[model samples]
Target: MMPNRVIAIGDFDGVHRGHQQILLQLNEWAASLHAEPMVLSFDANTKGQKIITDNRVKDWYFSQYGIEHWQVLHFEQWKEMAAEDFTDHFLKEELQVVGLVCGQDFHFGKDRKGNEFTLISRGITVKKLKSLMVEDLRVSSSMIRTYLEAGELEQAEARLGHPFCLMGEVCRGKGLARQYGQPTVNIPLSSRQLLPPYGVYAAWVEAEGSRYPAAANIGVRPTVESGGEPNLEAHILRDSPDLYGCEIRIELKAYLRKETRFESREQLFAQIQKDGEHSLTRLEMLK
Candidate 1:
C-alpha cells in the first residue's frame, strides 16, 4: 500500500506551544491512518526579527517528538509556487500527503493565499488547530518575542517549550573580570538572532553535556568598555572554568536587572556581586 502522510507545515521559528499542539494532533491523525507524520518548513526567517530558534535545533526537536520525516524548502524557490501548484505537485504527487495540518493563521503559496480553506477546497483533509489562547493572549512566536523583550523568562520558556538560548563559541575578552571579579564565558550575539533586552539575567550554561546555573549579561557593555558590540557573558555560578575557545550554550532563565553605567569600577563590581546572588536565588527555584 502507498504510505500516506500527514504534513505539518509552518515557519516554526520557536516551535511554541501551539506548534507542539498541532504536531501532537498530526501524530494522532497519522497513526490512525497508518501514515507518516512529517514537518515541512522553509529555511527562512521573519523580517526585522531574529529567530528564537533555528534549523539545527529544530531538527533535534523533531526527532525527540518521534517525527523522522523533515522537509525544508528554500524560501526563494518555494515562495514562487502558486497555491494550487504546491497542493498538487508537492503535497499530492511528491509527499503523498493525505492529511494536512497547520495553524488557523497559516498562509502559503506565491502571494500567501493558501490557507486552511485552500486545502479543504482542493479535496484534501486538513486540520486547522484553533489558535491557542493563554491568559487571553494568542500563543505565537511573536508572543514569545514579546515575553523575551519584556524580560519575562518563564513566560517565554513556557511558550517555546524550552528556555530561550544563546549558543556560540566562547570568545576571548579583555581582563575586565580578571582583576576585580570572576571570569566569564563571552558568547557573541552579534546580528544573528533576536534576544532579550540589554540586562543581567539568571541563566544556565551548558558545556559537553553538563549544565551549570549561571548569571549572564547581554548587551554592548557601556560601563566596562568602549565601542563594544552586542554580546552575551555568562559567569557560571560555580567555577569560572577554562572555557575560552570552547563552544557553549547559555539559557536565559530570568531577568535580574537592566544594564547600567557605574560611577566607579568598585561600584560596578559590587553591583555584579549582588546581581549574582539574586540570580542564583532565582535559578535555584528552577532546580
Candidate 2:
C-alpha cells in the first residue's frame, strides 16, 4: 500500500518565505491526519523558465524546515494531464495523498485548471495559504529573479529569508588566475539555473564545513579569453585548501562592480587584488 501523505504542492523554486508558509501548514495538517508531511513540486515552473533553486539548494531548504519527503513531477510529462485525472490518479491513487496545501495562487494540470476547490470536490482536505508579503510586495521566486538579474542581492536575500547562493561542484578552469598567483575555484554555470547579472560580487563561499570571504566573478572572462560560457569563480580572501572537485556554495552578500576588460594581464591581476580587498571590506560592513 502507498504511504499516506499530506502534501504541499508548487514549483517551490527558491523555497522563499511564501513557500515556507505552505510547508509549515502542511506539518500541522499532517499531524492531525496521522500522515507523512511531504512536498510535491515540479522540476520547473509551468512557463519553463530557468530554475531559481537547483536540487542541492532545494535539499538544503527542505532539510532545514523538517520536510520529510519530496517528490518531483516532471513538467513536460505532467503538464498536459487533465485536472481530474491528475487528482484521481496522481494525487490519490499513486501518492495516496489525503490532504493538500498550497498558496492561493497555485494552479495545476492542463491549462492551469486545478485549484483548491477542485481538491475539495474530489474529497481531499485542502489548505490554501495567502501569499507572503514584504514591504507591501508579494515575495515570489519571479520577483527574486528580477532582483538578482538587476544585481540587487540585498533585495533578493530579503525575500528568500536566506542568502542567495550558487551551489555546484568546483571544476578546473584554465589556470590563468593561478598563473597570476590569484587562485580561484571555478563552478560551471548550469543552463537550467537562473543567474545573477554578470559581475563581481562580495560573497561568502562555503566548502567542506568552513566559510571563507570571497570575491566572486560571474561571467565570461572577457579580459583573458575572447568568448566562452559564463562561469562562477571565486578567489578566497584568506588562506584556503585546494577546492577542486569539492561541492561548494557561494552565498552572495553584495554587488561590488560590473565585469570589465583590462588591456594587460598585469592590469587585470592588479584590479583583482583591489577587488579582493574591497570585497573583504564590504563583507565586514555587512557583519
Candidate 3:
C-alpha cells in the first residue's frame, strides 16, 4: 500500500519565508501521522506564461527544503474544475491526503471557489498560515518582485528572509569592460526569469562554497556600447581569479544606481572608481 501523505499546495512562485513556514507545518503533520510530505504544485514549463520559476530553480529550492515528493499537476485540466470536484479527485482519490497546509490567502478549484471552510467540511485536517509581516508590511512575492524591479535590494532582502539571489553560469563576453580596467564575469539574460533593474549593486557572490563582496552590473552594457544582449557582470572586489566556466550565485545586498554611459573612456573609468568606492562602503556597512 502507498504511504500516507500530508499535502501542501501553492504556486510558491519564489518560495519566500511565509511559504517556508507552511512547508514546515506540513512536515510536522506528516511526521505525526507517519506519512510522507508531498507538494502539489503546477509544472512550470507545461503551463507556459502563467508559470513562475523555471524548473531548475524550483527543484533546487524544494530539494534544499527536503521535499522529496513533488506532484506537478497540469493546470489546464484543473483550472475550470469546481471546488467539490477538485477535492473529490486530486485531494481524495489521487493523493489521499490526510492533512493539508496552506497560506490563509490561498484559494483553489474552479473559479477559485475552494476555501479553508470547504476543506474542513470535507473532513481534512487543515492549517492556515498567517501572512508574514516585515516592517509593518505583508511579505509577499509581488512585493519582493516590486523591490527587485525598483532596485531596492535591502528592502527586498528583509522580506525574502535572505538576500535576493540570481544563479547562473559564467559565460563568454566581448571583454569590453577589460578595456576600461573593469573586467567583468558575464551571465546571459533569460526571458523566463525576472532580473533586477539595470544598475550597479552591492552584492555577495557565492561560488563553490566561497562568498565574496562584489559589485554587479545588470543591463545591456550601455557604457561600453548599446544594442547588445542584457547581461549580469560581477567584478569581485580585491580579487581577480579565473571564474570562467564556474557556476555562481549572486546575492544582492543594496542598490547603488542605474547603468549610465559616459562620453569617453577616461570619464567612464572615473565613474567606475566612484562606483567601486561606494560599493566598498556599502559592503562595510553590511558587515
Candidate 4:
C-alpha cells in the first residue's frame, strides 16, 4: 500500500537554510497527519542556474532530515503539464500527497501559471514559507554561488548553513602525486557544478564515514598535463584506506593559494608539503 506523503517541493539546489525551514515544517505536518515526509525536487540540469549541489549530496540531505522519499521529476515530461492536471492527476491521484509545502515564490505548471492558490483550489493543503534572510540579504543559491566564485567560503557557508562541498566518486588519476609521497584522490567535476576560483584549499574529506583534514587543489594540473577542463584533487593529511571508486565529499574550509604552474614537479611537491601543513593547521583551528 502507498503511504500518504506530505511533500515539500522546490529545486532545493543547495538545501540551504530556507529549504531547511520548509523541510522541518513538512516533517511536523507529516507526523501530525500520520504520513511520510517526502521531497519533490527537479533535476539540477533543468534549471537555468548552475547547480550548487549535485543529486547525490542533495539526496543525502533529505536522508539526514528523515525524509522517506526524494523524487526528481523529469522536467521534459512535465513541463507542459497543466496546473489543474498537475494537482489533480499527479499530486492527488498518483502520489497520494496529503499536503504540500513550498516557498512563497514557488510556481509551477506550463509557463509557471500554477501557484499555491492553484493547489488550494484543488482541495490540497499548502504551506508557504518566506525566504531566509542573512544580514539584510536574502539567502539564495545564486548568492552562495557568487560567494564561491569569489572564493568567499565563509559567506557561502553562512547562506548554505553548511560548508559548500564537492561530492562525487573518486576516479583514478595519473599517480604523479603518490610518487612524491603525497597521494591524492581525483574527483571528476561536472560542468554544471558551480566552482570557486581555481586554487589550493584547506579541506575536509569525508570517506567511509570518517572526516580527514586535506590539502586540495582545484584546476588543471598545468605542470603535469594539459586539460581545458578543471578538476579536484585532495591529499588527506593522515593515512587512510584507498578511496578510488568510493564516493567522497570534500568541503572547502579556506582558500590557501592560487593554482600555480611550477617549473618542476619537485617544486610542486615542496609547495604541496607546505599546503598540507597549512591545511592541517587550518582544520585544527576550525575545530
**Model 4: per-residue lDDT, tens digit, 57-82?**
89888887888688998777888999
Question: How many clashing residue pairs appear in each of the predictions shown?
Answer: 1, 0, 0, 0
Q: What is the C-alpha RMSD of each candidate to the true structure, in Å?
A: 2.8, 1.4, 3.1, 1.2
User: How far is 279's C-alpha from truth in model 4 (Å)?
Assistant: 1.1
What's the best-to-worst order under TM-score? 4, 2, 1, 3
Which of 1 and 2 is the better model by TM-score?
2
Q: If both were scored by lDDT, which would come out higher, candidate 3 or candidate 4?
A: 4
Q: Candidate 1: lDDT of 137?
A: 80
lDDT of 3 by residue, 1-287 (tens): 77878888877767778878877888888898999999988755332533334555566677877889887777786788898888877787878877889887878887788987887888778888788888888887777778777777787777776777777788978776677777777767677777778888988788877887788888876666879877788888777667889888787788898888878878876777788788889999998
What is the lDDT for 266 in model 4? Answer: 98
Candidate 2 differs from the real structure by a C-alpha RMSD in angstroms, to one decimal, of 1.4
Error of 1 at 45 (Å): 3.2
The lDDT per prediction is 0.83, 0.89, 0.78, 0.89
Mind giving the per-residue lDDT tens digits that candidate 1 earns over 203-253? 999887788888898988788788888888888878667888877878888
**Candidate 2 deviant stretches above 4 angstroms:** none
Each candidate structure's TM-score, on Cα atoms with residue i matched to residue i, is 0.85, 0.96, 0.85, 0.97
